[model samples]
Target: MANVDQDSNLDGATEGSSNANAPLKRNSDDPGWNCGTLCDPLNKDAIKCKLCGFICKAGITRLKYHVSGLKGNGVAICKNASKEDKAVCVALLENPKEDKIAKRKREEEMRAEVEIEVEDNEFYAGSKKKRRSNLRPLDKFTNPINPEGPFLNMRQQNLLDALSKERTHSVHQFCARWMYESGVPFHSIDNDAFEKFVEAVGQYGRGYCPPSQYLLREPLLKEEVERTKGLLKKQEEESACNGCSVMIDGWTDRKRRSIMNFCVNSKEGTTFHSSIECSTDSHTGQFIFDYVDKCIEDVGAQNVIQVVTDNAANNLAAAKLLIEKRPNMFWTSCAAYTIDLMLEAIGKEGKFKEWIAKAKNLTIFIYAHHWTLALMRKFTKCKDIVRPGVTRFATTFLTLQSLMEKQEKLKTYVY
Candidate 1:
């Protein structure tokens, strides 16, 4: 390639003073052109070698073999050709096939790039002149060269439709895989915000980059907080108009810290008011009363129709205090909590307790041995004899019920 460039410069420099007989026009695309020139203006078969001034009667292909020191061609090797010139000729002769393949690949890549650019422009601009100018050779079949010609044939239209469907399926698979791998809930797909997000991305087209972690955590988080505040404000207004109940629930978190949740329920919906960690404070009647009173004040005393709490001794004491303080508003025990307490008391009875203990021992034995557990599952058709529930007492009852339902299967397994 360097030799070719040097030869080109030499030709340009000597063009003015050169003999009129020297070939004026050069085939720049051919590497053999750098090694020699055509002997006659009209005869391409005869090449005059620059190195040895040997006029080969054969074509440039034979001249290249001669200059490169390759024998057996109809021409003699150029004795005056230097080693560097021989190497250049050898490389050019040997690599034409590989060079042609590489050139074709580059051309295909360039065509693909042009097609994508044209598609993007067509999608956005939709101008006839622009589309005509940018249309690929293959596209000319579907897209009319003249405005009077018919649009895409049925075959081409179907092909385009299939491609669009494939594109949509690919996008869907990408989104589904991300959600599945990331452990995002399936029901989140039904969320209005998620649907809108997909639509927004489609509208924005190809270059839509998702929000970074910092944006999601900082600015987006702050925006969502403000939006939630607005919704809560509306809920508060409804609560005031319709009258709401203040419901208190106490539970321990995974860290074993005692936490109390305060919620306000109205016809509109239930809104979580606040939560407080009471691990450091004693859960006395006074503490409960103070917290409930503060919640009532926050919700507005007139809007609070009732204060509902679990039927625990401290909660009962707090109810009495609330009744005395707010005589107009009612104080009540949670009915669900009362039922749970009844279930707990019934489970502790002698007969029920003994049955529960035996059931627990059977479950423990089966679960302890993998073989026993697998046998039980096979007999039960993969249904376990233990059924958990939301509450401890409810879970016990549910498990007992499951045992009764699976009694035949359990007997078969045991035998």
Candidate 2:
């Protein structure tokens, strides 16, 4: 940046130029042009010095730059120009008042040039004229190119029809199909195309647009769960119910480690132990009880009704703490498991053991063997009630009942 000091004169003179011997003068016709010796007296409406061409535009206010003695691109020679040309050109470039006027004049000139080109092109579209026109009129009446009919191209229309047919399926599947088969050589999608696709997908993009999970997926989902839990906690706080209930169960996997499942019933949604936390170490009675306490504190348990669990001693022990904390808190053993236990106890007394063993074997054989159902159909006239696919929980008594009634041929296996 260049600095213009008030004490400096335009004729490469500085501090010494402000002497009495120096006087500034201006011509009546010129506005900013001046000739002068510095510190000269000036008439009203007089800005230039006739002697030195120094500008006194701002009344001694100077523009200070970071660098001293640095000059920008040099100004043009205007002394030889006619007064009118000088005035018009200099005013066009420098006057703040002429900005809008100059801009309008340039725009008018550009519009005229575009009109002439379009006329010439119409007269000679295929006669040595280029296929494309660069300068087209902006207004609707004069514009030569416009989309008059169908909005989508052939490929886009086909994709739209396919997606409409499979409206029940996910939008991602639709997009994936079109993106793979569009066959248009890979090129940048225009703004209109991209926006159209976004509009087509609509709200389906919320969960369907795959998130880049990487390592943070679990952490992010956990945060979401906690946020949902907070809303449930708010509901619990508002309710006046005297007690809440919890249920606990555990199972050992092929890895032989006990995994627990806990459910806390509240006015809010049922809170199930997610698979991620099921394998955590909370199997013992004390541990499970402590875990429940922590969960209560997490949700601010003040109005719990009762806790319920299977006939596990650990569950009973944990129920003790809840009774102590809230005297009204009650515990109930699961009746379904209790009945199964009673049946198991009675089965040990007589020939019922043989029947139980045979039932277990027959159920397992039909479930674990794939060809047993077909074999059973061949031997007897009795129709098999088992469904014609893999049974997800075929070993359960409910599913095994269908298999046991079929009289399926048994296939033995040695493990």
Candidate 3:
């Protein structure tokens, strides 16, 4: 029954195709025919073209293009009227000369009014001398702390020293524990400042000294965090060549809270490694815009080229605002994100799911036997994921390439 219905639909489509080739018949709706009161002077019998004997079509755009004067004839008539024909041999009668002049005046007035309306709203109101809270100059940052001694004392230092000696321990992990033991706030302190201090004193080719004793004194961390932020803001302003792109993404904290994280990135240079602009607050479109604005103000906007991100609406909106502000700024969508979106769309559409399920079942089938697992690994080369531009992913091509290579193996694990 379904096959019969499909065949019937196909037959109807074929009939429509045959009818499409039939020659067009002239009617009142034809383009070349003057349906209005104005008539072509040469037309009398069926209002036909006298030269080519072709009937005038309805809904002609303008008769002026069809009107032309011959050497002796008052006006030659259109014999070869067609949609594409350039030469018009027929003169369609026009309205009185005064009516044409009045229409021209009305069109001019309408155009003038539109221009005035555009000019009225183009300028926005703002204070020229205003200090935008977002754009704090470097001199505005005020140091709020006076230092004295090692942040931690001898006993806490001993524990940190012991933790540092352990192969698997990181100083950040050790510092967090030390902060907990010393009764000083570690999580509340500025992480970047603490991180720098720890690196400089404990691990920078200088043998492990209980440097937290000197560095982690009395919750100077908050001040350090502020100071570090201020320095970063200053460096971005001072060095216009910092060639970094900022990425912003949002997520919920463990407490089911919303947060935005801003990260700055760039390729490593001859003298310095690439830098990251980690924002102090949650990521938001406004935050991202302000960050880009500040970065542009610091380094000239022209120096920064492209911002790459996943196709999140907020990120897309931010890119638009950035482009409006800095017209030359280019935006590239993240390659991995683009490919994932394409594949996800395909999965939702029900094409890829069966294949994906098959891959999953293959994992179950192979893993049940140890020999099958070895054979599977030996027979299969890594899966090839599509690159960013392959569908929509253009930015971060390498990242997507790597992901695609492991796609078959990862698909089993990814769901």
- Each prediction's whole-model lDDT (CA): 0.76, 0.48, 0.47
| Best of the two (2, 3) by TM-score | 2
Candidate 3 CA-lDDT value: 0.47
- Report RMSD for candidate 1: 34.6
TM-scores for all predictions? 0.58, 0.40, 0.31
RMSD of each: 34.6, 39.9, 30.1
Candidate maximizing TM-score: 1
- Off-target runs (Cα >4 Å) in candidate 2 are 1-243, 267-269, 273-284, 346-354, 363-374, 377-396, 403-415
Candidate 3: where is the Cα deviation over 4 Å? 1-239, 269-303, 346-351, 358-415
- In terms of lDDT, which candidate is strongest? 1
Tens digits of per-residue lDDT for model 1 on 207-323? 224677888899989999999889888778888788899999999999999999999998878999999999999999989999999988988999999988888899988888888
Compared with the true structure, the alpha-carbon lDDT of candidate 2 equals 0.48
Model 2: per-residue Cα lDDT over 1-415, one tens digit each: 1455533345334323543344443323333333222343534333443423544443211111001111352322424335554444445344644777886676545333432223332322225543332332322223222123232211112132233434323444555566679764445343344544454333121112234555357866888779877876655654445445666666677987666666766665566643224455656667777776776565446655666678877788877876787676677887666766765665666776676567667656755766765555554334554443322222234434554543222211110
Candidate 3 to native Cα RMSD, angstroms: 30.1
How would the candidate models be sorted by lDDT, starting from the highest? 1, 2, 3
